[model samples]
Target: MARHVLLAGIIGSTAYGLAGPGSDVDRIGVFAVDTVELHGLRAPRESYVTTRPDVTLHEAAKWCRLALGANPTATELAWLPPDLYETRTALGDDLVALRRAFLCAPRVRAAYLGYAARQLRTVERRLTGPGGANPRVAKAARHLARLVAQGRQLYRTGTVEIRLADPEPVRRFGERVAGGDLAAAYRLLAEAGDDLDRGRSPLPDRPDDEAVERWLRAVRAAHLAVA
Candidate 1:
């Protein structure tokens, strides 16, 4: 059976407005199949892919689960600019409408900061390893800085800014990290974490799970009826 592609949009560096001349265009999407297919002898795959520019499409249920957990990659897909979309059906519009339903201050803090911390550790390891300085460390540092900045904005505004609206400061911090200034990188991460720990965020502690569930059920029902 043909997969129903509910949403498809640009992601990665291009989606973030950080793409350079050599940057590859990356895309992600969500697709849904009839519920019966999921309950049959062979379960539908959780993901699909296409090559060239590179697109990774997750099953709708799987995407919803990841978004609920504030998986940065998956959640960000819902916030992409309208012009960036290559495909968006009514179901996709509904999915995007519920983007805020997946956001909670605490989850954003954990997801963004935790991912940045992992990047920092990777950079630290690379710095101490025989490879010395490499482009990967600099890239990781840039992403780490971006994550902290994005996390802060989300906590304060309840919305994520995928592209760095102001990239200068992050650019400078990335330079420090690239120069082997691990101290500065750690400081940035700590400061971001501390700010979030203050618990001053105006966002709710948990997402609107009921609303999301209702939407999911409606979508599944519509798909099943047509199938």
Candidate 2:
């Protein structure tokens, strides 16, 4: 069956306004499977990832699951700026409009900080491992900072800010951490923890699962109609 992409958008360093020379242009998207395929004896693939163009397209149901869990990378699709979007169907627009339904305090805090922990490990490895100054480490450090800032924004304002207002500071921080200053990375992470602990956020304690279910039903219905 032909895959139908409902939404696709530029993400990663480019979306955050932190891309440099030779940076990979990453794109992520959501696609719908025919409703009938879901009942097949063999389950259809839920995700398609290609490195040639650095794109990942998730099945609609899978995308909803990840977003509902506050997966930082997955949630980016729902909050991308208009220009960053490469494709947006009517359903895609609806999904974007309902992004707030997927956010919750506990999941946001856990997912962001949990992803940051992985980046922290990368920073630590760069500090002690050979080739400490490799560009990937710098990228990881930058992502570490980005995740914390984005997470904070979502929790504090109930809105996601994809592009950083001041990206130079994040770049500088990455450089510092990649240059063997693990303490700098730790300090920033600690501050993020503090904010999550003390911040009075506008987000709810639980996500609006009913709204997500309604949207997913719409997606399935749309696919079935076309089929």
Candidate 3:
């Protein structure tokens, strides 16, 4: 499974330029199974997640489906900076080139904002639920900020910036929220909604399904040829 990885890259805080001391090095990858494997009654696993090394690998077809829906975490793999990549084949390069073909206005808007909403719930839980002042409250807050900002940028420009322009501000914002400034977090979330509502995105209303299909077929063909 590891050997079949087509594309994999560093992601999360490290790739976002927000890592500090003790931050985990997270990675995401795309892999392919032999085409013949799909002909059987049982299908091969489509995803693998590990906590020790903090890595996740998704099969090629599954990855394409998630990317087409504008899933922020899944979509980041194709947009990661060159230096962040640990594996890159010709097939991987093709996937990266088709990254934009996966974006669409409604999905981008819905998926990102929806993800941000979930992060907001986590922030509320960590802040008000169990232990007082959990450090994860800050982490959740930071991600909440990142998702909104990144989502807004993606909606407006049709591309995601993996590295933050100024991570320090976001870090500070997180600290402030962690220190019981919930109002600020709410404000940021509200701003995210407003930004989404105000834009006429350059992205089409839907992803380029034909392009994605062609690319997925190419991946399967490549795997079959190699096998």
Q: How high is each candidate's TM-score? A: 0.93, 0.96, 0.97
The whole-model C-alpha lDDT of candidate 3 against the native structure comes to: 0.91
Error of model 1, residue 152, in angstroms: 1.0
TM-score-wise, the better of 2 and 3 is 3
lDDT of 2 by residue, 110-183 (tens): 99998998899888887678755777778899999999999888888888889899999999988888777888
Model 1, position 95: C-alpha lDDT score: 88
Off by over 4 Å in 2: 225-227
What RMSD, rounded to one decimal, does every model reach?
1.8, 1.3, 1.1
Best candidate, lDDT-wise?
3
**For candidate 3, which ten residues in a row score worst on lDDT?**
218-227
lDDT tens digits by residue: candidate 1, 95-129: 89888988888888889899989989988988778
* Clash number by candidate, in order: 0, 0, 0
Which is better, 1 or 3, measured by lDDT?
3
- Which has the greatest TM-score? 3
Task: State the lDDT of candidate 3 residue by residue for 43-82, as single tens digits.
Answer: 8899999997999999999999999999999999999999
**Residue 185 deviation, candidate 2, in Å?**
0.4
Would you list the rank order by TM-score, best first? 3, 2, 1
